[model samples]
Target: MAISYSGYLNLPHGFRSHDILAFHDRDSEQTAERVNYSKNLLEKGILWQGMPACLILQFKKKQQVAITLLAEGGKDVSELEILPIVQRMLGLNQDIDDFEKAHYRHPQLGTLVKKQAGLRVPLSSTPFEALAWAITGQQISLAAAISIRRKLIKALGITHSCGLYCHPNAEVITQLGQDKLHQVGYSKTKAKTLFNLSRGVIENTLPLDDWLTQQTPVEEISKKLIEVPGIGPWTISYGLLRGYSWLNGSLHGDAGVRRGLQKLLGLESKVTAEEAEKWLAPFTPWRALVAAHLWMSL
Candidate 1:
């Protein structure tokens, strides 16, 4: 029998369900599993430490959000565990003031921020998932990357409701060979890197969860992530931007980000790496938000 459970999360002011949904809705990947919109509410399925559940989150009123967690067998998860999961996934606790300061420096940012208020950098429900996404998306366009991700999920992910699938966990990755992933649209190198990453995690060589929970600085985390094969500075920055909401993170070498930066700065041509850094340096501690604003502008 299907089991049902529900929960509530109190959100701070400026939290908007629409903003969160928009983030998911804009994903260039397969739609149904990424998020579902129905009956005036949005639903997303997530795995909490390998436990599958569907979360319904939406703003109900001032300082309040309505949340419901549905899982088979009514599996019990403590409030402490569930709350942080909701907060981090939806970025309910991320402060936008860091981004707001950028608007103060650049008036154009004011309009973008106002238009996209309550916009938070959405994150993977799990840290390893974040790492996996970063690795999977490398060297591909957003649509192509997400398409590959969807195929990977369907091939290996834990089954969920409505014909959706959760992102495959590291353990599942271990069970699959490189050929298995390549058939699902991964390049040979991506497949190998992911296989190695899964092994690294299982072997405790890659402690992603520790980085998330502990007080390691973003720089330190970036340093550690880059040491892994197929993970680079851009991936580290992208991960930090999504998971940590690190304001100083830059999508320095990202093609889209470079284009956005060029357009934002009124440059006639694309910028070199050093030029990008030089231009973005003035927005320290908010460079990531600046990137967000540039994306919004485009």
Candidate 2:
């Protein structure tokens, strides 16, 4: 049996739902089962509290301003749970006034922000899901990583009649061995990391779910995440920005980000991680948005 609900949500100022959905268009890291942006609607499937869920969203405006979300054909989710999950997945709950204020002073970031206002950090459905994506994308191009993850989801995720899928939970991933994972496009080292992360979370060794409500520092969480095999600084920083909305961090080692920075800063040579850090310093607390906009500038 499936449970569902539909309701209006308050959207943040300048929020363009399609532009946010476009972020999902390029990445295959299985951020959602299916994410489609059209002229009138945004449709997606996500695992909500470990259950497969599909949502059809539309913005409504008049005397009352709101966005509509219709949750359909999923198990074990209440209406209350759906909205918050959607909010987190789409970054509807984030207030970017501070980010805008902080970035307004930076010469390049100010123009970037103006060109791409209300572009949220585009969070994953949960911290665990976010970490899974980071693990899959290590040492590869974003498109290739996403392709491998898509294969993983096709092999293990739940599906709908319309052919959309829902990403599996850690419990499900833990059951698959290295052979199965490798068949689904994971390299040996990446496969090991996936198994370790899934089993660690399942056995309470990772305790990623604890960060959902518990007030934990981002660096503390990163420290724990990188302790897992094959995890590294780039994953830690990217996960902080995408999974937990920790915006103060920079995308120091990302090749694409470095290229974007070098071009935006008018540099002839490549921007090293150290140089990226120095350039990112003035942006300070707004690096998250800067990175997001920088990627767009590319």
Candidate 3:
């Protein structure tokens, strides 16, 4: 039998479900896609206590969100347990009013923010997933990275009866081993980093959960993540942004960010990383959001 729960949440001012859906739908890889977004609904498979369940979020006309979680085959999960995960995935907890107010009059991002108000950073279901994605996308085209990600999930993730794959957590990835990762098209360095990251999580040495629970400072976690081999500033920054919603991470090293800046500036030449960094410095704590707005502009 399938078990289910439903609830309603007041949408934040300027919240646009389409923007969140578009961000989630960016990767078009196969393998029983974990997240499925349509005009008014989103279906996603999420693992809780190692059991996979399907979550549905349906947007309503009055800025109210209807959330539902369906667990198949008598698997037990509480609405309380699932709501927080839903909140994170939807970025409901991330307040963007300050970012909007601060940048609404700016030269470059002003118009973009106004047009894209209530844009929130859609977070990974788990920190490990974000870290894994950052490693997977390093120095690779987005399409190629998404292809590899599909393979990885197909190889190791638990599939719900709903036909969606629950993103593999650290324990699942660790058991797959580096050899299997190579089969999924991860380079040796990336495979090694995955192994290292998964092991750290397994051993509690990385303390990703602790960091999230305690709301640790981004600099503190970034310092720790940087020590892992094959994990550079870009990886750390991207991971923190997607994983923790730390909006200050400088994404100057991202190609899409540079391209967005170039287009924004109407420059004929490519924007250098240094140039991007300098331009973004004024944004300070909202740099990642600024980068996000830039990506949307593109």
Model 1 residue 123 lDDT score: 72
Q: Write down the TM-score for model 1.
A: 0.87
RMSD each, Å = 2.6, 2.9, 1.9
Q: Which stretches in model 1 have alpha-carbon errors above 4 Å?
A: 1-5, 26-40, 61-63, 107-111, 114-118
Ordering by TM-score: 3, 2, 1
lDDT of 1 by residue, 241-292 (tens): 6766566786777777777777766788778877777777877777776677
Candidate 3: Cα lDDT at 141:
94
lDDT of 2 by residue, 1-298 (tens): 2435656777765676666566666654434534444444555666555556666566544311233333344444455766766677677656577787766666776777777777787787677778888888887888788888888887885764344676677888888777899899999998898898888889987787677667588867878888888988878888777777777777877887788888888889999989888887777776766777788778
Winner by TM-score between candidate 3 and candidate 1 = 3
Model 2 residue 100 distance off true place after TM-score fit, in angstroms: 1.6
lDDT of 1 at 165: 61
TM-score for each of the candidates: 0.87, 0.88, 0.93
From the highest lDDT down, the ranking of the candidates is 3, 2, 1
Q: What is the lDDT of residue 204 in candidate 1?
A: 79
Output the number of the TM-score-best candidate: 3
Clashing pairs in 2: 28-146
